[model samples]
Target: MRLERVKEILLQQVEKGKLFHAYILEGKNCDHLAGVFANAITPYPEDIVYVEPDGLSVKDKAVMELQNRLSMKPLEGSKTVAIIKEADTLTVWAQNRLLKTLEEPLGDSVIILLSKNIENLLSTIVSRCIVFTVDEETEITDLEKEAKLQARDIGEMLLRKEKFFTITKKLAPVLSDRDRAYAFLDALQEWYHKLIMVSMGIYEDDSLESHLLTKERLFSAIDHIEEARRELNRNFNVSYSIKNMLLKLL
Candidate 1:
């Protein structure tokens, strides 16, 4: 979904006085956009509270603070809007606390949870709110387009449990070209990102590829790709590091 469309939806909901108690905004630039939405609705900073992660995770304390903020009347508006950035990093305890807050409505206060990876969120919490998915808007070049196809084939090969040698041989060409290799990695990440959305019921694509993205392994697949990226960034041998990643993934 585009940011403008999301804004339109929210505006319509507000106009109808039928706005939801909570919304899960999941996608690229979601946290920034959440701020935009909150600012648009509540000019007063006090009326728009933000609950962000403390260091590495959103602890239960932050969720409690959020609940406390919403308990009060709006400082200067008809409603309050609370935003939880990087909601995917919320701790289990925090999620439980948040779940409780969701069960009890606090005035017309709204909670907007921003998540780049929606799968990390509890399904129960997701069920309680409207979810908006926004894709990254970067334009793909022709080279990148071909890289995506190549990456898709590689991913399918991995899912089919192909022999490691065959998969590595296929990856050789991509790794030989630095640009194409990076583009291929990008494509792979995008594939898992979309499939995750599909599995999570945020996006719909009932293709064979979606079938390949079985819930059993789809959840942890991105971690492998991400580790490969980190290894490459650290000047690790491309072929060796990627092969190791593939081995672990298999």
Candidate 2:
């Protein structure tokens, strides 16, 4: 479902007081959407339990910790929300341990699992939760349009094996503007995401770029774009990160 549609459904559920015990929010930008959903439940920060993996995987210990927390009543509100970020990274044992909670959640508690991809999760666990897949496309601003065009152009150049100097020159001006640089990175991620959807026959834009690229190549592009975004978020040098990402893409 599109993000907007998911929001609408969630709102209706909230109004009717018919919220499920568990929900699996699956898609890119899920972390952002999860925040929105969490706020909709309650404004009290103390009522929300945000869980993140200590490392690559959410260990069994973390799941046990969550289980212990949920055993107690809500600290501030009638409902206690537990948000597990990057839930796909949960280790097999952790997921298995979480299964019991999903199967029989504590009083007035909601467990929200956010994942970029849900396939990593067990089918039984997935079956126990409400699943929402985000695929929303909003109206783009002029800046975003320009950024997307630049991303497409750079992608084409990279695919054609353009010279390093040429690619760097095209990207330099974009990196110079901080706002546009972030937009460019976001557009780049979206561009590759669209390609992946097209490759999977889930999207039907039928553009030359989508037709020319394979799923593997699209995944590679998306991964590089995500890395660049993470670097920029961490205050890495903008130009350096973009250049590094472009080189990795090549």
Candidate 3:
């Protein structure tokens, strides 16, 4: 969902006095969503508590800190909001610990899970929340879907034999400004993961683009993709990051 839509939804929920158990925000632009949540709760003190998943390794400590924030008697509002960005990046131990809180969140508190891939999340974690997908643009036609399928097929064919750079060059323009910058990165990450799976012999299907390639080349390409992703995260020039990724994959 778009930031505006999330704001609208949260406002409506606040008005109705119905707090959500948890909210899973899945998208490429989650930073935008996090900002929107902060903005939505800014006017209403005691309505939001933002958490960072930085170097903290103790999930209980993190949860305790959040609970303490919520424990503060509502200064002016009827609800409390907590946003966890890059939730999927939480360590397995941390994610497991978080499951306890998700199972029984504090009363009148809403927890938001900002993640790109909900598939990696624990089923229990997913079950206790309302899921929101960000990019519900105009419905796709069958032809468009077919073309994407074809593109994916072709892209995979190129990934084989260590031909990452060529596919990057040919397909990069098919993306939009936002997609090229962020969403494409997420897609590339997913692709690299599939390549790892192939290298490990854990994969049998080649329908996904990465699987069409051989394992050795896939793993080699993944290293470069990961490096590019890191550079983007480090606030390196985005245009440079994009170009670097294209050069590596193409």
lDDT string, candidate 3, 130-192, tens digits: 556566456755544544453455446545534655554565553324335455554554455
Give the per-residue lDDT digits (tens) of candidate 1, residues 1-250: 4678666766655555665678888787876678777776677887888888899999999898888878888988888999898999999999999989877777679899999876677755765566676756766579778977877788778877899999988888776666666677667766765566455554445664445556547646666766677677677777776787788767
TM-scores for all predictions: 0.55, 0.55, 0.48
Clashes of each: 0, 0, 7
Please, what are the lDDT tens digits per residue for candidate 2 over residues 3-27? 8877876766666666767888888
Per-model lDDT = 0.75, 0.77, 0.60
Off by over 4 Å in 3: 1-10, 37-42, 45-47, 55-60, 136-250
Q: Give the TM-score of candidate 1.
A: 0.55
Root mean square deviation (Cα) for candidate 2:
11.1
Best by lDDT: 2
At residue 53, candidate 3 shows an lDDT of 69
